[model samples]
Target: MTESLRISSIDLAQFSESRDRRPTERIPLTTIIPRAWIGFSQAPWRFVGLTALMLITVTGLSLISKDLQQGEGWWQSALSDVLFVATIPTTLLPIVALLHLADQLLPSIQSTAQNEPVQERQRLRWIFRQTTSLVLLEGVILIGGLNMIRIIGALIARQSGVISTVVLLAGGLVLILWTLSQTLALPLLVHHGHRPLAAMEHSRRLVQNNRLKVLALLGLLIGVNLIGLMGAFIGLLLSIPFSALLLMASCRTQTPWVKDSRRNMLPT
Candidate 1:
């Protein structure tokens, strides 16, 4: 019994030491953004092509919608709505490509950390399978949340005007927080093979003490993409991948996966 107790105590100490050695440092936006640009440059042509396609589809849809608005028929509105729904899946295509790019880039980043080359090839079939589920899950979550918020807003609006304003503000705040919490979900899913709910939980935990940094990174990506729009939307081809790499870098730096690798290297 005494020997068992001693071994348990020693194990606890080792566990504590391992936890202490894990990096809690956040990657700076400056580092991540620049590296993201480098990653975009190195990305495969397929990713770039997909991004371009999405941009073209969106632009074409916008033009069509504008033309439809100039017409005066009940069918015009119905057609516009149909076009809008069709565009939703197109938007997910770029996102799917981004996630695959991030997953491919992660091993290189990890290899750099370990000072060793990690050769891993991305399977196109796997990427497609994973991306389909992820896109569907995200679509459901976003659509469901927006609908709930809309319903709540409507119900509040039926009450006092001032109260309705407060409710709307609160709802918006909640939505923002929820978004921030899930910022790392896609990366977690892609890199760690976590399920939808698990990935979201992991993301929430990872962002717990680093919400501000995450929000700053998100803002930086948005600003960069907006700037890209200045170049006739052609810049989005670069910005979209760049932002994805930045997000992946952020996730890689914060996750405990690297520390786990280090622990595995230690004498057991």
Candidate 2:
């Protein structure tokens, strides 16, 4: 028992030391996308399959909803909004799963290899917590904020279209930036086991520290998805998964994996 405790202490020290040393590390801008390509290649089918399922379910629902399709009356418009909000969870779950899949394929991205392994049960629990928190937080900020802007703009529209337009544009820009900052949250949760808020905070810090890299990532993904859009459904299948992999690769690059040898830590 004493020896076991001593070994545990050494492992804890090594883990802490590695984390402290990693803050200065950064992956080159050019390599992040390329690394994601490699990750995608390793599991192309899995990526495509998950994306396909998400797309089918979401598209099918949208197509079948006559009220949403017509979107004519105020009630229909409101119902359309509800249907759109309903789809957010479906979208989020797949994204979380994609990140998880990427982490599994590229284990080096996760810190668990050096610590206590996250069990299947714990993984599921984390997923539930992450999904619920993100849905609530993002819904309030992105959806609710947009609604607030619309309301405020409408209320003040008699005064000036220019002011209303400015408010809408400014609110949109803030939300876009907020969305970008959250790029790392799921990756952080899957790789490092951070709770939702902690993962979000860490993601924000990472994006702030590496704005250029994150921006480049987003730009590339948007371009890729746009091209995918041109190809119709087939293109999205590849691009969506590829985007998830790229984010995971970026997270891996930010925090390189470390595993200290027990032999090296034994008192000399």
Of the candidates shown, which would achieve the greatest lDDT relative to the real structure?
2
Model 1 lDDT vs. the true structure?
0.69
Q: What would the per-residue lDDT of candidate 1 be over residues 1-268, giving only the tens digit for each residue? A: 9999999999999999998786664444445655555555665575678778878888798778778877899899888878877786677656766666665654334432222333223343454566567667777877788788778878878877788777778877887787778888877676676767787877887787587888788788889889888875678777777777777767655334554543312111
After TM-score superposition, the amount by which residue 122's alpha carbon in candidate 1 deviates from its true location, in angstroms, is 10
Worst 10 residues of 1 by lDDT: 259-268
Candidates in order, TM-scores: namely 0.67, 0.68
Full-model lDDT for every candidate: 0.69, 0.74
Of candidate 2, the 10-residue stretch with the lowest lDDT total is 259-268
Predictions: Cα RMSD each: 7.2, 8.9
Model 1: pairs clashing at backbone N, Cα or C within 3 Å = none
Please list the residue runs of candidate 2 whose C-alpha ends up more than 4 Å from where it truly belongs after superposition: 1-28, 67-85, 107-118, 143-175, 255-268
Candidate 2, residue 160: lDDT: 95
List ranges where model 1 is wrong by over 4 Å: 1-30, 44-47, 69-77, 106-165, 254-268
lDDT of 2 by residue, 82-182 (tens): 77776767776777778777766653433343434567657756776776786577667788878888898898788999998998898888888888888
